[model samples]
Target: MTAAFVAGVGMTKFEKPGKREWDYPDMARESGTAALADAGLEYGQVEAAYVGYVYGDSTAGQRAVYELGLTGIPVVNVNNNCSTGSTALYLATQAVRSGQVDVALALGFEKMLPGALAAGYEDRESPLLRHLLALAELEEFAMPAAPYMFGAAGREHMRRFGSTPEQFARIAEKNHRHSAANPYAQFQDIYSLEQIQAAPMIYDPLTKLQCSPPSEGSAAAIVVSERFLDANGLRDRAVEIVGQSMVTDLASTFEAKSAITLVGADMSATAARQVYAQAGITPDQIDVIELHDCFSTNELLTYEALGLCEEGQGSTLVDADATTFGGQVVVNPSGGLISKGHPLGATGLAQCAELTWQLRGTAGDRQVQGATLALQHNIGLGGAAVVTAYRPAS
Candidate 1:
C-alpha cells in the first residue's frame, strides 16, 4: 500500500487542570482546529476521524467534533491504553493509505484528576478487578504511579541484568533536563542527578522524580493520502509515513518470563524490521526518536529493544550522553513521558507531533539538526507496542 503523509500536527501545553475549565472535548477541539489550520484545511476537509481516549466516556469523539462544527464524519473512538493516540493515528493512516479516505484526523485528549488511576478498566465488581486494583495500589506505592507496571518489570530487569537504580535515575535526569527546554512540557523544571536519586522513593530504586505526572492535554494530526496531497498542491511539504507496525504481548504477570526478554519482542522487532525495510533504512539511519518512556528503566530497555544500542548497554548510552539532544541519536527531545507528562491517549499523537516538528526543522530549541529520519514508539497495557517511521519530503 502507498504511504500516508502527515500534513499537519497540533498540541496544547501540557498542564494540570484547574478547578473548572475546558475539559477533554474542549482540549480535543482546540488541538483539532489548530491541526486543521496548520494543514490549511477546513473542518469539512476531514473525511474521517479517529479519537483516542483512556477514560473519556462514549461519544467523546462526537462531542469534540461537535465543538469543532464538524458533523457526519465517521468518528471512531479508540482505547489502546497508553498507545491509544498512536493506535488511533495508525487507523487513520491506514484509512488514507488504503484508498478508504483521502483526508483523516487522529486526535487524543485527556483530563486527569488527582488519584485517578486505572479508571479506564471496566467497573470493579469482579474479583479480578479487585485483585488488579490491589496490585495497582501496591505498585503505585512501590514505583511512580504512571509507570507502575514497569516497576515490576524494572525490578525484574535489575534481577536479570544487574541494572542499578542509579542508572534509571540518570535517565530521569536526562529527560528532566531536556524537558526544561520544552515550552509545551508540563514540567519544565530541571532536576540534577543527585536530586533525582535523592527524591522520595515511589518504588524501590524508582523515585517520585522519576515518574511522569498526570496532566491535561490534547494532540491532533492531519493525515492525507498522496493523491489528496497531489490534488491539493501539498505534496511538496508532506512528511511521508514510511512504516507503521503494532504488536501485542502476553498480559498476565505469571505468563511473563523476563522483563529484559520483552515477550512482544518478535512482534515489535518484526514491525520495526518491516518499517525499516519499507523505508529503505535501518535502525542506525534514524536520526531522532520518540519512544514511550513512562519510566526511566522503560527507556533503558527500549534502547536495546529498538536496537538503538546493544543489549544491557542502555546505561552506557545514557551515561555517555548518546541519547541526549544533539547526541549521536536524539531521543525524546520533547522531554519524553518522564518530563513532558503522559496524558495517556494524548501521548502517542504527541510523540508524532514532536517528530513532525523535528522533521520539518521547526522544533525550535529542542530541534535536532538535519533530522531527515525519525521514529515514534508507543506501548499499550499488556505489552502492545506500535512503531512508526517517517521521513521528510524528498
Candidate 2:
C-alpha cells in the first residue's frame, strides 16, 4: 500500500447540544469548507467520501456532503459507535493507500440531545448486549452504561493497582487546564483538583466533571496519496499517517473477568501494538497522543494499555506527571473528550485534527514543544478501537 497523508483537517467549535443554533448539515458545511480551504483544493477533487454519525437517518452522509458540493462522489456512511469518526478516517486512508482514489474525504458530525446518553432504539437488540452481560457478571450497574462500565474499570484499577479517586480527579484537572487554551473545546474553564473532586460523583471515582458531555460538533480530514501530494505541491502542509489499525474486542474482553478488559483496554492494547509494529517505533518514541477519555478513569487505564507504563502502574505515571505538556509525551493536549467534548462521531476526527496541528506546529498554546511523532487512539465499547500514528510529510 502507498502512504496516505492528511493534507488538511478542520473542525467546528464543540458545544453543548442546545447551545448551538446550527444543525449537522451546517456543521458539515463549515468544517468541509475549512478543510478544503486548508488543503487548497476544491470539493470536486475528492473522489470518494466517508461520512460518520451515530444519530441520523440513512443517507445523512449525502445530505451533509451535498452542502459542500454535488460532486456525485461515493459517500459511504459510517457508524462504529463512538469511534465512528476514526472509522471513517481509517476507510478514507485505506482508499488512498490502495490507489482506489487519489484523494478521499473523511467527515464526521453529531448533533446530540442534552442529558445522559440513552439507547436510541429500545425495540431492537442492543449492540452492547455482550458488553452489558459482561458488566452484569462483574457488578450491578451503578450509573448509565458509559459511566458504569468505565467506572467499574476504574474501581477495579483502584482495587488492584492501588490507584485512587484523587488520581482520576487529577486527570480531569489536567485536561480542563489544557482546554483553557483551546478555543474549540466545549468546556475550556480550568478546574482545580479539589474543585473536580467536589463535583457530584456519577460512579465512585468518576465525578460529573470527569464525564464527557453530550456534544454537538463536526470534523473533517482530507486524505491523499503520495502522488496527489507531489502533484499538488502539498508536502509542506501534509501530515503522513505513518501507521493505522482498527481492532475489535477479544475473548479476554469477557473471559478475563476484568472490568478494565471488559471496557476495551485489551482492544486498545492490541490496536496500539499493531500501530507501533507498523510504524516500527516504541511507545516511548511518541511525542504526543490523543486517546479516548470519555471518562478520566479510561485515561489512566489507557496509559498501561498503550505501553506507556506497565499494567497497574498508570497512577505512577499520573503521579510522575509524565503524560502532560512538560512531560515525556503530552497526552490530550487538545483537552480530550473530557473537556474538548465528545460528540460521538466527531471525537475521533477531532483527535486527528488536533494531532495534525501538533505535527505541523500549529496547535498554539496547547502545542507540545518539538513534537515530531504523534499517536491517536479512539475506541467504542460495542467494540472498535482505531489507532493511528503520524508524522509530518517528508
| Predicted model with the maximum TM-score | 2
Clashes of 1: 3
| lDDT digits (tens) for residues 1-394 of candidate 2 | 9999999999999999999699999999989889999999999999999999999999999999999999778999999999999999999999999999999999999999998888989899899988888788888866588899999999999999899999999999999999999999999898999999999989888999999999999999999999999999999989999999999999988889999998899999999999999999999999999999999999999999999999999999889899897787999999999999999988999999999999999999998989899999999988899999999996
List, residue by residue over 1-394, the lDDT tens digit for candidate 1. 7669999899988887563387887798789888888888998888999999877788887887677775688999998878899999999999998999999999999888764365444655532343245455334333233455566667766776788898899889889888887998998989889999999877676788887777789999999988788888876666899988887653333233443334234445556777777778888888999988887878888888788776666778877888986577999899999899888889999999999999998999888999999999888754468899989765
What Cα-based lDDT does every candidate model obtain? 0.80, 0.94
Q: Best-fitting candidate, measured by lDDT?
A: 2
Worst 10 residues of 2 by lDDT: 134-143
Quick one: RMSD of model 1?
3.1
